[model samples]
Target: MEPGTARIAVDLLGGDDAPAVVVDGALRAMRADPDLHLLLVGPTEVADALIAALDPAERARITVRPVRSAVGMADHPSAARSESTVRAAVTAVRDGTADALVSAGATGATVTAAVLGLGRWPEIRQPALVATLPAVAGPVVLLDVGGSLEPRPATLARHAVLGAAYAAVAHSVVAPRVGLLSVGTEAGKGDRVRRATDPLLAVEPLPCGARYVGLVEGYDVALGARADVVVTDGFTGNVLLKAIEGAYAMAGGPPVGGGAPRAAALLGVAGTVVVCHGSARADDVASGIALAAHLWRRRATELVSALLDGDAATDRTDRSTDTEVRTS
Candidate 1:
């Protein structure tokens, strides 16, 4: 293997179009990165097909961890069993067999497995799933895409720090401007959660010299004119991300840079993990694997967590005052 090789464990049966899409994506990723190694976590037959397609020399870089069970999209997070493919991929990271993992499985199941197998960082009750969008102005890092569906004000505050650190460490964004997603830029324009979360973010000590830019609108997220890192509960972020992708599809193609990514990096977990959309295509799966390798090489997860430790007050979020916001 080349120096700094990133061995990524890929869940072969994770996506809506499994085995076939995954195999094709893995082939593309391996061909693109000379140093990339893969541990195919799925059925032996499925893994064999991929290996058979590769040249003998290239086949040496691949390993198979035969796991037949997979978590369906309709299944609950609790369905993440030790024998399942996603859980096995997490185990590879936890056991040092793989540097990171990529899964196009159920987001909740992947998050659950990562938390159960690798454990969460200190004081992170809800691990955020952060996605980077290549906007016209620059890269926009949005968090809680599908990790915590209904986070409290304190959780949103915590994720603000996570987004800031991720933007700086992973994307080389300096002094990231953080913002809470709201219906309007005006203060208190959103629901009770947005109004409550606004002040917490303003007072919260952000890492990487990040500053809270207060509330931002949907336009800010798409154009990247207002903030570098946008924080929101998982439900809204997830909905918004899909909507952006659909808009791009309707527009004939994405922008010159690219459109919304089908994959996101899971923060607050101890190991590097990339979660792709369940309906991910071959290119999306390839992008997810590439993201995993990139994160492992940068040691993004470790550095981001260390940044969190610098601010002792980040963990002091008083969740007792948190109330559920009505989405209706």
Candidate 2:
């Protein structure tokens, strides 16, 4: 619906339902955004089906790049190294053939592909998956939803900076408040990692006039009365995001604005990529496509990288220790 045109590369065989759900979502996204142009990266037959369903006006906006190989949901993330649909989509973005990309495939596979193809920001050793939740007051940006499950204290501190910049740039929050999610709001309430990251975040200088706001509890994620950006380990952040979504479902529906996002924007990678729920429905895929368009149009990945360019590294103690969470 926005004025600018956004060319999105879609992985047609990425979701749990494969081309069926992906095709349905692509059709919906194409109809919703007049300026949206989709490069369907999957089987020729699937692309043909989508093209057949569209009217002449919509059909003109679509382009198909046929790719037969697809990684399975249970396949190892390294499978992305092969000539799979997801990898091809990544190539499209890296080669400037598409402004952005969307996939509902395995999260690990998608993340792996993006990191391998597009590459990561210089200082960002571990790329993060960022999801924005519409809170009571405004959008609450949460990070490391699934990217680095067992990042060190320094990684948490860095994600705080990334989240702050994203809030200010993506969400337009003024002097965004950044917080570290823990068991309790008190300074030393969480485990060793939280305690380790808390002090580091306190001193980390955030871009876009953002500032750290001490520790916050899980309730603040949805209510958002405390901070605009919540930072945590990928394992914890991933679990927390899902728990909030489950709670919203149990309550019959998401809050007035919307529930947790089914799609998350992958930050730190040098490209605009959106990862959707593996079991994405039609709407979820559409949302992911829409999100990719929005992010690409705003040049979020480039802007976030620019914001981090000038900041000096924090002297975070290497308290990485260890956790049970797995990352690709």
TM per model?
Answer: 0.91, 0.91
How many clashes in each candidate? 0, 0
Q: How well is each residue in 46-140 modelled by candidate 2, as lDDT tens digits?
A: 78999999999998999999775542333534234223888999999999999999998888889889999999898899999999999989999
Residue pairs whose backbone atoms clash in candidate 2: none
lDDT value for model 2? 0.86
Q: What C-alpha lDDT, on a 0 to 100 scale, does residue 193 get in candidate 2?
A: 91
lDDT of 1 by residue, 11-33 (tens): 98887777689899999999988
**Model 1 misplaced stretches (Cα beyond 4 Å):** 1-3, 68-83, 313-328
What local distance difference test score does each model get? Answer: 0.87, 0.86
Q: Residue pairs in steric clash, candidate 1?
A: none
